[model samples]
Target: MGVMNELIDPPGIGTLTRILTESAPMVEWKQTAATASLLGDLNLRARTDLVADALVADISTGPVPGYTTASASFRAALAAPKFTGWVLWPVSEAAVTLALASDAAEDFNDCLALLAELTPRLTGEFAVRRLLARDMDRALAAILTWTAHPDEHVRRLASEGTRPYLPWAVRVPALVRRPEATLPILTALYRDPSEYVRRSVANHLNDLARHAPDAVVDTARHWLAAADRNTGWVVRHGLRTLIKKGHPGALALFGFPPASVAVSGPRLDQEILTVPGELTFAFEISNTGTRDVRLAVDYLIHYRKANGSQSAKVFKISTLTLAPGESRSISKRHAFRQMTTRVHHPGLHALELQINGAAHGRTEFVLEMA
Candidate 1:
């Protein structure tokens, strides 16, 4: 029954007070105070149902400005509870965004239309991703559409929002288990006109590289072959994991390769002391190149932990500039104790020689029981 003040929060509450007093002279002060109190309670813990009911009532009775604030506050409140479990909320972009942000992980699903339209402008892309994480099939479908959205923000969200292990969001096992499923989405964004979107794509691909190095390497290869200037850097960035693991495709992309491989000894005396156990390495390095070249030679050891899983640790025991026809023998004593480093069980441990930047040769050695 009165004019509404459209003020952004941190609102000038006093302005609303004056507007309410003057616009609705017949309106009781108590009612106005109640409205103000409801607005203020946004920062507190309140019941989701109660807040939703109050907001719906406000939206139905008040002017548009009041309706907007009430809706936003109500959605914010709902986000704290099981909003995702109840999928029947009056779907507005604001309410949908908030519901996605909720910690509730029951039967919630996103409306594709709203998701396509709103995902770009939504502030908390990571929060929205949590809801999607529960349903990869749905999330991928919606993200595919959003990837082509005209808005850069929305396009960016299509990639950033779908990380395999996005923080605070539900972990999408599909991405981690089978990163290949994400290739379609990544492919679409690879050549996107928007650098922002492309960068997100690169990061997403890199995320995939953690679990699926081959998949990322393939994608990077295609991008690099095309030599698309817009996405060249993105391809490079996306290859980080593969490069780190000494994948040949990745190293070759950068025009570098290891020319030799050799090993020194199987002696136990030179082993380094590890509290729980000690590690000994015998390596033979060879220079296959004709020119004398400097190389960063080291071995990567994968040790088993108490939990029966393996972890990789790198040791840089030697670096040398070798003659074109020279060979060298090297031994490294790696000691380990406690569970701090990778645990070595009674199983075979993986060993690899990294020559220059390439993984030259790989072998398995038994980790004898102590």
Candidate 2:
């Protein structure tokens, strides 16, 4: 990615300079058209408003490399007092949109803050989020007030704006790392009168679920019990993966009944491998008796460590709706990579499969570490 020259400069002037430089080349056409539109306006404020409107109209234009089109046009447009108020609003929106389309550079951060100031005036909630996604702290500060704003649009931004992995916006890894701070914000908006705002709250809660499953599950359960169909939809969408894979707490939240399950060793029913490297396992489940049943089958791996202790982590292997006579098989591969899980010491590793809430089967294999 090419760095913007003004990106490295100090905040205020640097941002303005970069905007000017990037927009200078296209200034002639944008400003000329704007000025032409305001030819009959004698009042200064009205003239500025017209210019501001013009800038917004042409904001989607390109940077043209060395050309300073947008920056110059903005300069000419901002000259009118009428355009000033309009200036920040449109410019903020345009800048936020632009930032999402590019990587986070110093210029991007500068643009984000500049745009955030005008958030109170802008009607788009998503725009505020795109800007906030750059810096979690700044985003939290600006939006905390917006949550109380009378405008539903602004209020929604309070929740929608701080989503950890909001689509099209830069992902805020910090927020993802420490999701507790986000709880109050989500709680305030989860039951918002406006469905739009409430939907955002649900999504925010869901985002937190990836790292903090317990929190997400708890919050979602509280919301789903009293939520309407639309609200329920929002909660379900957010919890889709967790529910589909039959997360224990998630299954319980959805009122799924427990069913008996059976899992066999790797490669017996399907292909299997013993790993110092990688392995594959085939898990099968059947409804032995009657009664319609919805069940969740999960697996946990116990890695043997040099210290002779075992470390275990759980993963959802499958969810099934079994009828009077139904059986299903799922094949999964386990890679002994440093990323997913750590293999402490080479020894006999144990695997346990949990059905509903009980451990139903076990398998063991030797892992040799070189």
Backbone clashes, each candidate = 20, 19
Candidate 2's displacement at residue 306, Å, is 9.3
Write one digit per residue (lDDT tens) for candidate 1, span 97-212: 44444454421443334444444334335444545565678767767887777788777777877778665454766678878887888888888888878878878888888888
Model 1 is weakest, by summed lDDT over 10 consecutive residues, at 1-10
The alpha-carbon RMSD values of the candidates against the true structure, listed in the order shown, are 10.1, 12.9
Give me the runs in candidate 2 sitting further than 4 Å from their true place. 1-145, 148-153, 160-184, 187-203, 206-218, 228-233, 237-247, 261-280, 288-290, 301-318, 324-348
Top model number, lDDT:
2
TM-score of each: 0.56, 0.47
Let me know the TM-score candidate 1 reaches against the reference structure: 0.56
